[model samples]
Target: MDLNWVPAADRPDLVAEPVRPALRDDVRVAEIDPALADTAEFCERYGMPLDTSANCVIVAAKRGGEVRYAACMVLATSRADVNGVVRRHLEARKASFAPMDQATSLTGMEYGGITPLGLPAGWPILVDAAVIERSEVVVGSGLRRSKLLLPGKALAELPGAEVLPLAQ
Candidate 1:
């Protein structure tokens, strides 16, 4: 009931300039205990429904000695279709979650706080269609000690984002 969301503008590095303005006016940011940053913990501690929380995971795949990176967003109720839909879409033979080192370093976000917003350009974002239907969803704030909440449709409109049935 109390998400404690403040203005997202206060967190500059955590939110990219381009991505921030594109988000809706109702989007909010809030400080959270780093320990509760993960989906289950955050939902349990904050009294938010698990179904309304989304996980944005970075994935890696290789093809012909070249590596491709992608971010897949799925609701906590479901897992990302990594090896199936994601692999096929990336056109890679095998796809798996990116290492913590790579994911955090590339996105400039904490391991447990990576969000779909502020991802490196050229990286494709595959959002589960179901996740976009929620009126409000809680995601990471680029820091384990904070979280961001916004309309699910706002994420659907991000640059290079594809709203697909990407969860199983």
Candidate 2:
């Protein structure tokens, strides 16, 4: 799909208040096949030397026979260390990655194309602090074959995202 045809406001609602700058001026957006959204392939295809890209992962924790959804935003440079940081913060005995089947089914986003922008409500987004410093970074566009490049700070403010010192 050509994002150029979609007006900024008409774009899918992000989790955060819609505060996008003119995307073309501050960052770049690329539309590639869904296959390229995979971490290894995205980096290789884009010739990105670093993995500072934001990885949107869905996590599930059982809350009294019900499951809660959360979004984990880790720097591709590091891991979420869910057991160490995320679980502790959530006060849960265990926090696990949602199965690919469940995540895709719930988020309506392809497995590799999940971006923090359009996650389900009540899903807390945890962001690694280091990502805040990057002038520009690539992240999923709620669809396969498309990626958004923009100032890191703009991403940090996405709805429900809590910028925390969660990275190594």
Candidate 3:
């Protein structure tokens, strides 16, 4: 994709505040048009395939008057099994996408740019098996104006991350 990849740690401004401390040496960041931050537009504009992009979706799960939030990482071409696999995995009676305001505020990241890297402590990060098998993948940098590129294995190594067949 011809991106000028730079160490994410060296470009703190390119990532969200919470993401800064989680940045690993293997992660790279590249600037992009904020308008193209969405998966479809970003991949098409960069001539990248859908399989090379990953999306991190925030899910809100509830059980016995308690709500737990999780981040699900799925390939751009796949859909997260939120109602099925996720609900069961989280042991929550109900699971749904987190509201934009809550997601952004809790993650300390922009709505469309939330990434699993810097999620709050104790939040389960369910990573689709397909995503972790890839050698490299593009993901949000916690900011709409840039993107993060790293080996798929890196995602699986994040704190609270769990590799699972969570995509359908």
Candidate 4:
């Protein structure tokens, strides 16, 4: 099957790194016949090394302008304190988790399949610096039940991915 490619223009805020074309070969994409809601189990069953994977979570915040969404990218080994770190980082008067529906709708990726790779341009992507410390990691491939295994360095290179100290 031909890969479902999301063009760069559509993901204005998602930073694409200058990676070797070989990266496409290392990462695999699979379509979930029936979408699964649990991200942890899906990663384990797919032989995804969670220790090196960056888990992406979408948090909603209203910072001066219209309500905006920010993608928090943290390593599987660590967690981003949404209320503490992410909330402050965004400097929103009110911050909360975006409902699965809204998150999925705003981002073209499934709830359990959302990644920082192809998110909406306006959505801010804040990545935990520790994620870049790892040599390799698995990330969502824009679909439920599918994953992308690639070098951690590649993820940090994505545009607008600010490496922050966000592990708790």
Ranking by TM-score: 3, 1, 2, 4
Q: Rank the candidates by lDDT, best first.
A: 3, 1, 2, 4
Best prediction by lDDT = 3
**Model 3 agreement with the true structure over 1-168: per-residue lDDT tens digits:** 456789998889999998988999999999888988999999989888999999999999999999999999999999999999999999999999999999999999997799998899999999999999999999998999899999999999999999999988
Model 3 residue 125 lDDT? 96
Residue 60 lDDT in candidate 1: 98
List candidate 4 stretches off by more than 4 Å. 1-37
Against the reference, the lDDT scores of all candidates come to 0.85, 0.68, 0.94, 0.67
For residues 40-102, write the lDDT of model 2, one tens digit per residue. 777776677555577878888665577777887777878886777877776677889999999
Query: RMSD in angstroms, candidate 2?
Result: 4.7
Clash-forming residue pairs, model 4: 13-121, 15-159
Per-residue error for 43 in candidate 4, Å, reads: 3.9
TM-score preference between candidates 3 and 4, better one? 3
Instruction: Compose the digit string of candidate 4's lDDT tens values, residues 89-160.
Output: 888877787899998888766667677876777667888888878777667766654456567776677767
Score residue 140 of candidate 2 by CA lDDT: 71
lDDT of 1 by residue, 1-168 (tens): 356677687665445343464445677888777888899999999888899899999999888888999999999999998999999999998899999999988887788999888788889999999989999888887788778888999888888899999989
lDDT for model 1 comes to 0.85
lDDT of 2 at 15: 14
Error of 3 at 138 (Å): 0.6
